[model samples]
Target: MATGAESGRRLRVGLLGTGGVASKYAALYGEYPRSLLVALHDPFDPGAGELAARFGGRVAASVEDLIASDIDAVVISTPNPLHLAQASAALKAGRHVLLQKPMTVTLAQAEELERVAEDSGKVLALYMNSLDNPVFRDLRRMITEGVLGKVGSINCKLANGMGHVWRNRPANFWRGSRAAVGGGSFAMLACHYLNLAQWLLDQPIIRTTAIGTNLMCDHIEGDDLMSAIVEFAGGELGVIEAAWCVKGEQMSLHGSAGSFAYIDNSVVTMKADSPFIGEAIRYETPGTRVVLDGLLAPAMSDWTNPYNQHRCFVDAMLDGTPVPMPAGKGVQDMRVLDAAYRSSAGAVHVAVHVAIHVADDGAVAEAVA
Candidate 1:
């Protein structure tokens, strides 16, 4: 079997949505030389046809039509409720899957998707695009590699003023419905930071104490503000906040040897007393802006950047390499989100357990984390 790159064949891609995030990816796939955006499907979104036209693909009549068409991969950017079904269908149809974040609405659904991916032996990468940033990558490296030795705690906040819009959104708007999106700001946004904090520490989030309320958005069926205290498997503490009623982005890590912090997700500053760095250092990605949208907001304007996750997704598919952002990482984030929701509802702490199994080949084949 010849890899797509080896054979000099562009991988055909089917896009499953045409919303903002989907449009960003469509632009990327249009520019990526190794993958062609060959088709797109979105029953509720009329812009699907326009997106296909702009990206050089045809309008797929339905998801089934898209999967059965001549496409080797599927990019799923649908609502949270539809993720499991759409991804399962695509993977079962012998198409690689690139699923957008917050994996699924429930833990069972996430685990089921993971199982489906495992059995199919197809790529099931998650679109936690921030992992591709050199700043974040360096932060994770510094922490895990002991430059910030034995991080004792992490504090992160990801919020935006989207609740104000959700309050007046039509009932058909999927994001305002709790059942449709699992949760408001937390599920929609927090999963990224939760995954990032865990990735930085290289530890599993083991417990959560949370409080959530619809303090700002009266009509939405989910909490607009949420704050959670989480515990890592290695006893590190995390304070995470996600709100649709506010606007901010920041994260800080405190460790035995030094500390690391970033504000607006652009200016990264770290100080270490270790030999790795005896002084303070600051790093910034120029031309980035503070946007109401999540991390991918900056990348949309420059998708062709070498560090773009879309490039990684295409490269992995063409080269037959491991997924850069595996589904297991998303599963772990979902576990933490699940525990947070449960903890808020119960007004108590909830314990989380993650079962990850490594195959003899050293790949993480299955995980319910």
Candidate 2:
């Protein structure tokens, strides 16, 4: 464990999987001078070699070889099923881990990885990058600053046509396998909003009722359309709708003082009283462009949400600071996801068995059933 003060040299990083997601991280890694991608590993030799060539790193022969290298951290971008084993291996080998979303396909795996991370005394973070979105961060700040004034409800919808493309692909499409990726749209895409809902509301979902179906993209094993209604402990009601059939994105928050809506990543805010004085205002900044700019840039920019997230993770490891998205958060998110799936499968409202208690010191204590 090298502290920022102890080591002025760049932190060496090993990429555990050379998939599409891995390539994105590799590009980001190239942007940070304080971090260097030193090794790449994947079962596919060509994929690993491609990423290594593009990112200026050597291809390791195997996962074992990559973890055994002198890298200080490992970014696990493999499929959901492999997350637990790879992350656990990295942590046990005395290296930090940056695991991709959904953490694992099961709560048991997530819990085990959480425990392993805790025992290792190493940083284990989930790649829930949406939290780093500038609009989301600003919205959270506004709500915290009382601009929203007691949020009562939240609605989020993300419908894209990716399912059409995915279904036509080969049967080996890792995401199409429920056994490999957990759930479908809910797990793959909606889970991001689930995390955002909790983050923006600052509350844990106490109960949830969900309905999911593989209405379209029948070739896939999981649901392509899913909707979940959740009740927060603070009395805030949330509605989340996700589908691979439709094509658009929007989120809105309703509060006592005012309301805010985010459509396609732009924000429109309105206040309670406005005699044409303080009318609704819209801020226009394409979210996709922001993310793309971050990805295309030569250096990491704190202004870009995703890059900022990776930068935070690197800083946490080097400075011995707290991780922005810890493994516990991933576990909790997985619990909500599992509850949604159970609720949908049983055709009933499932009680979220997790109890979140805020201690006097402001530390959160979670007990999951």
Candidate 3:
């Protein structure tokens, strides 16, 4: 691990896979004072040694070797399919894990990972990194506090534009492949919206119907664009639109009595409506964003892109506290996505079982959506 002078204490990290996702974890985790990317397992590019040189750690020859290393945690940043395998290995090896999103494309795989984590009693966290944004944190808090009313409906739209799906590639480039990604835009991008949806409404998706297709990305096999309507346990409806359409990027949300708009890809909201209409709520960036915007964040700007989720997982494992966003929830979200796809294909409504609803009056109403 990376030791700093006499402190001699750093949270050891064994990172598996060296892809865009893993790189993000590497960069974000490096910012922590107590964290070090000590060991790595990337047969394609063993930057662990070089990373160790940069951050003060060692490069392991394989995931198994890394597991054997005295690391505090593991960041499974491998491809979509490898998540379960790698995470299962790390959990059995007695390491906390920060698994990348889509958790797994299939419910079965997700359940297996969940079962392992539960059996081992280790921390298994999912990096739905965007939720780490301070804005999202505040957003959820407001909804929980009833700052937003009944939340009768929610509309979410994300535009990929011409940018690469993973970096200079098309949206859902890898995710478009079912064998690889499990679902189309619904699984990859809409999952974020769905996650936020459940959080915002504090309810589960009661029923859903969706339609998707690979419209723009001619080469992609899955849906580049997907439109879905989800009814939560409270009969609250949510509309989602995702695609690699727009040339740049965009995202926004409309709620029962308020709305949120983001511009220029910043997590900071350019505009947010109050539960009472035109009333405005200033943007409060999410926790992950606050740490990510670098030193400039204290100046009152939005901070984003840090792997605070992983940091939280690290803390949870070390401290034995149960924080939200566990790997099991990631698995649940995949099941929801699977439900939506099934609904879309069958041209019928699929029901969801987990639901939590906080009324506009601050009362908690829970049910199976």
Candidate 4:
């Protein structure tokens, strides 16, 4: 495969949407050696020009204008509803895409996007900020290595004060529309941890039961406080609680032989048997602290440090490396979110209808069971 690097040229990039999440990723195009931000488009945000000024791109007149320009790829950070149309357009135009979280508002849209991506033969990577975390990598390693014997359950709580932000105002913003975001806290926030839990366990969540309500944020259309208990296909259980009305985070991974607990993904505490560790061990970042006989601590990663997720996307496009987070994985994520929403609506346990399958050629396929 011929690459931009091999041709002694950087891959020209385009950006859609200029919101907070877009800003978080836009800088990498200018910083990474193999990519350059050449065009940008955001109809609702006047700040698009400012983003282009800082990130070395020209703010295009429209999405069509941006995609029609001389760009090889696009980074889409728009609202949930916009995801399908924008991503579909880009893929049809033969441009690689890096899309924001909660891939789409509906499972149908996700499945459609997946089909388009597979047919287009272009890279469609999901931009998940949590995937950059080194902690989860270490945790996955420990679990896979049987350091934590027979993992049984994973409990997570992710909350924030977005309810307060929406309380004083009317339902004016895009986030205030359930038609746009799919759900409230669970869709916007809990989806991240849900994907993470399944990734760590290397299995699909077969069933979920959830309860959610618009407790304090009546201005928002969906749930402000939501909790769900998920059953993995491997029989491991997961407890998830997400709150837009509160502000805090906690995650615990329990195993028959040990357990790991942490808050805000920092200052983790680990407890194991005599062979693994004598007692509880707690520590923070910077240095590589040893846990057992060579297991290092989950040190913090500066995701903006030139070689982050965005760079990985560039490499995948130009160098034919594996996509960091594939579009099929995003479809599975949508299935989990869909199950949670269905379970909450029915007040009963709902089964995730989609299952993941790997092809003989190593491509991922969706099996609707």
For each candidate, the alpha-carbon lDDT, in order, equals 0.82, 0.78, 0.66, 0.81
Q: Candidate 3, residues 1-369: lDDT per residue as tens digits?
A: 322434446678888875555665665556566577777778867565566565555778777888999887888877688888888888988888888777986888999889999998788887766666555566666666555544566777766653234445555555546678786666767787777678766777767778887766665566777888888887877787777545433345554544555443454343223332221234343221121122111111111333256666655555556756877678768777888788777884455777889899999988876
- Estimate candidate 2's alpha-carbon lDDT, on a 0 to 1 scale: 0.78
Candidate number achieving the greatest TM-score relative to the actual structure: 1
Displacement of residue 79 (Cα, Å) in model 4 is 0.9
* Candidate 1 structure quality by residue, lDDT tens digits, 1-369: 887777988888988988776787888887778888899888878887787777789998888899999999998988899999999999988999999998999888999999999999888999877776666766776776787777899999999888886666787788888888887788888888898888778889999999999987877879899999999999999999999999998898998877777788666656666534212233232223222223222464255666677777888888878777799988888889898998889874465767878888998865557
lDDT of 4 by residue, 107-190 (tens): 989999999998998889898766666566667777887767899999999998788887667556878888888988899999
How do all models score by TM-score? 0.85, 0.83, 0.76, 0.84
Consecutive 10-residue window with the lowest summed lDDT within model 1? 285-294
- Which portions of model 2 miss their true places by more than 4 Å? 1-7, 45-47, 267-307, 349-369
lDDT (tens digit, per residue) of candidate 2 on 183-205: 88888888788888987878888
lDDT of 4: 0.81
TM-score (C-alpha) between model 3 and the true structure:
0.76
Residue pairs clashing in model 2 are none
lDDT of 2 at 60: 89
Report clashes for each candidate as comma-separated counts: 0, 0, 16, 0
Candidate ranking under TM-score, highest first, comes to 1, 4, 2, 3
Worst 10 residues of 3 by lDDT: 294-303
For model 1, the stretches where C-alpha displacement exceeds 4 angstroms are: 274-298, 301-303, 349-369
Off by over 4 Å in 4: 1-8, 274-307, 348-369
